[model samples]
Target: MIKHHEPLETAGPTVGAGAPAAGTAEAAPQDESEHGTLQKLKVMQFNIWLGGSEVEGGRAGIADTVATVEPDVVMLSESSPERVTNLLADLAERGLTYFDNKNPDDRAVLSRYPIIEHTSFPSWSKAVFSFGGTEIAAYSGHLEYRYYVTYLPRGYGGGTPPPLETSEYGWKKIPTGPITDADLIMRLNEASGRTKVTQTVLADAAEERSAGRLTLLAGDFNEPSHQDWDHRTQDLFDHHGTNVTWSTTKAIEDAGFCDSYREINPDPVLTPGFTWPSDNPGADISKLTWAPDADERDRIDFVFYYPDERLRLHDSLLVGPSGSIVRSKRVQEPGKDRFWCPTWTWPTDHKVVLSTFHIATR
Candidate 1:
């Protein structure tokens, strides 16, 4: 049984979406003559539940998570001042550094390089993004990539975890409109639809003007892809980013962006391999909720790249190499919850995700 250092809070953003917020920083000049120019590197997204019933570090937990990813830049949501502030403080303590949101955890980013600009998109109500870093005229310092970290409202809330009902999953036929009833299913779908549109607008903007610079958006998108998020359940998000599960489950597939993990590891493997069932280490997951089914290990968290993608950001700090898992669990202070499973662990329920990269100009 893998022991955990308990702590949690809101179901925050996915891997890259909720690590740490980044702020403007001074750019460091590069030596063109020495190592020459470099190409743009990888971007990452994740959700750290924060301090809650499931996980419980609050801001302190977020701080420890930041160190784990070791990303060049990061975006996080559902995090608060205590969490963000504590993270910056922790970074400083560990010889690391970061910038924070003056207003709490609306959205933020942390980076290895200096941040040149940070702004929020109009589409995302509680979302913000960062597009700043050392930009050199040449390819080496070329900061041609921009990133967004977001968290949409959960389509289903206040209900006993939902049980899988059918096989349509992501394609659960959209209910006939004029939705006037207060049925839980209808209301949740409506909320999910709104979130879908919002994210689509944001993603479209990035994809529309991606001038050879890849635009990536990451988060615990309350709505999963038509295929993955739904599985045996109903597909609520029919219009998210580019293409969704339809492209995958259909006979004629239209995989919009490459699912990086699949590209690298062809044979799909249950991420986190073990330690998900809220009940047992590997219980009878068939009966759990679709949102977090123990057995169905789908990609709720992800890394997507536009056609403008450059050198891919190497993956694997989060799910370290075989026999070398880098724990994202944080050190606990006194007077905090101690349960480790089903709720209560460092930072948030979702694990802290990390991705690192350096500009490529060679």
Candidate 2:
């Protein structure tokens, strides 16, 4: 699910490695004492599939989606440096100027506003920028893909190598029934290092919030949320009738971050917000699915924000193909959950999460 690429073309000004981008220093300062200034801010969480190289015209599709949505900030996963370069150029041609720190990691932050400061970690990155006098700190992450224990409950291998019965090299079906032990599932999920990495992000985000910055975190977590897996729908989505309090999302919630998508769309049964195994018209079904015989659809991708008096969640929606790969077939999801389908070609096997907020700035 990870890929490397050679640098393509560069478009707008990009910051050098380990340094802040150039635009923020030039931004005019707005007095913090002013009040009643509210601006609509839209943030998008996207995983450009293998840097948008898995399908033809996929990179262009990424640019098109950003241009169409016009999000103020984009937390990008699987964004190779090459893909980021090419995407900036593509967006520039479309008359939209976006800036990236030229992150060397797979996860990167792209912003329509000036990137005042940034820091990058092993699996994630953060960008601090100002929007109408309200400082915002945004963290984007793409967690480890190995030891995806959710698949174990679906009667499939979870990409962890042997020694364990549920461990297998690739996406292979096991001859056993669903593993319904909640503790075992949590242990395997912990081994993936998602919880550890998320804790690091939360610690840093806490500092930012203490400094009075509105904080937003979004990513392709590669794990289900604790909120989604209660007694309500554990039997559905191949949970095998077991309820799991997935540790990663639980940590974020415990740290006082609101799951933005789930906040607006509360009912998991009606608006599941499944983000993975999206039906890509340009790619084959085999490439899209990990478990061929299971309803592996899950709401793994997410957007979380530390609630503040300055921030109000307006709306959030999944942006991608309406149909998803269910049991290895493209099936249209039926419910109140509707996607903001792209007018251009849809890219990636993960649907993008776009959330709108009204940020009050002085």
Candidate 3:
């Protein structure tokens, strides 16, 4: 079986005492044999929401994010070549090495360790590749971020979208109807396509399924639940994903992987740490305008940890809170005001997420 589903909930920030050391970088532990082994892996997955418009310059947001929680290995989504290049440059200044982010269409993996190898699995759509790997192939992205030309719209956020959920109680209550939410249904199917890519890679990794080498398939999967598609035409549209709830957790589980958070928390999903809203809340009045800790709802950013339990998972956490969306103040000085156009907030509608994994050869 796909490892009995362990329903889990979002684990809010760890209060003082049990919290991992903030703003500190410790060397990844080593094994007695002197072979490179991961001591601890704090893998984090986050979607910078189309970029990082919620904050000032997504650069600042990215830097601040890394400095805040400080994960050793991070898998970020929705990034572009420009943004990734900028992030790499900025991260380097801070003594952090961003491995294998020099690509297009976002979906990047910024690691503190050296990347061994990198490859991309071009999809049938010809628009986006389903998989990308590096020399190490340990922390590789086996699944594609999906951009089916036949199904996807001409541009990002284009084409027929899912119906805006209108609930009798509120946005909290996932609308249940005879017809599936149009856009949600489409994204859900797109999700399966991504999973197909993931399974194919995992099947290959099965040969070297030995410990130490970890293949993490993570990032924002714009789909929800492996069950519960009771919406307009959910049976027709939601299709195979109809039975699943509004959760990517279920989708990854379907790919023969385990939810990293669930592996630790055992709740149904990430509650307080919903990354979809960019922590600043979105157009959803009920869910938007995140208030430090009050805004508690659902999470769309999912992390699927392939059955690699050897890399000492410790302090494995999702370090994210809302980021600052500071509107640029009009500073009329020597063309410098708009000279350095904040390359972050103007980029997109999501906040950046940072995570680290401490690898040790124990």
Off by over 4 Å in 3: 1-14, 22-38, 122-192, 207-212, 227-251, 254-256, 269-273, 281-297, 322-362
If scored against the real structure, what TM-score would every candidate get?
0.51, 0.89, 0.59
Candidate 2 residue-wise lDDT at 71: 77
Specify the highest-TM-score model's number. 2
- Model 3, C-alpha of 190: deviation from truth (Å): 6.1
* Tens-digit lDDT string for candidate 3 (155-184): 112122234222122212122322224465
Backbone clashes (count) for model 3: 68
Please give, for residues 1-362, the per-residue lDDT of candidate 2 as tens digits: 00111122211112121111122212333223235566678889999988778988788788877776667889999888888888888878877688886678889999887899899986889999888778999999999998888888898878875676466535677776677889988988888889998899899999998899999999999999998999988878888898999999999999999999999889998889899889999899999998989989999899999999888887777778878998989988776675766556677999988887778876
Q: In model 2, which regions exceed 4 Å deviation?
A: 1-34, 162-165, 168-170
Error of 1 at 216 (Å): 2.1
lDDT of 2: 0.81
Local distance difference test values of all predictions, in order: 0.33, 0.81, 0.41
For model 2, give the 10-residue run with minimal summed lDDT.
1-10
Local accuracy of candidate 1 as per-residue lDDT tens digits, 1-362: 11222222222113332222232243232223233343334344535444232332344444544454345545554545665666677667755666543333344444555444344443222222232422311000000001100011122122222352221223222233111122333334333333444444344435434433434444444333333333332222211222233221121113244444334333222232111112221212222233331122233444443333233444422321111111211222111111212232243434333333334333
TM-score of 3: 0.59
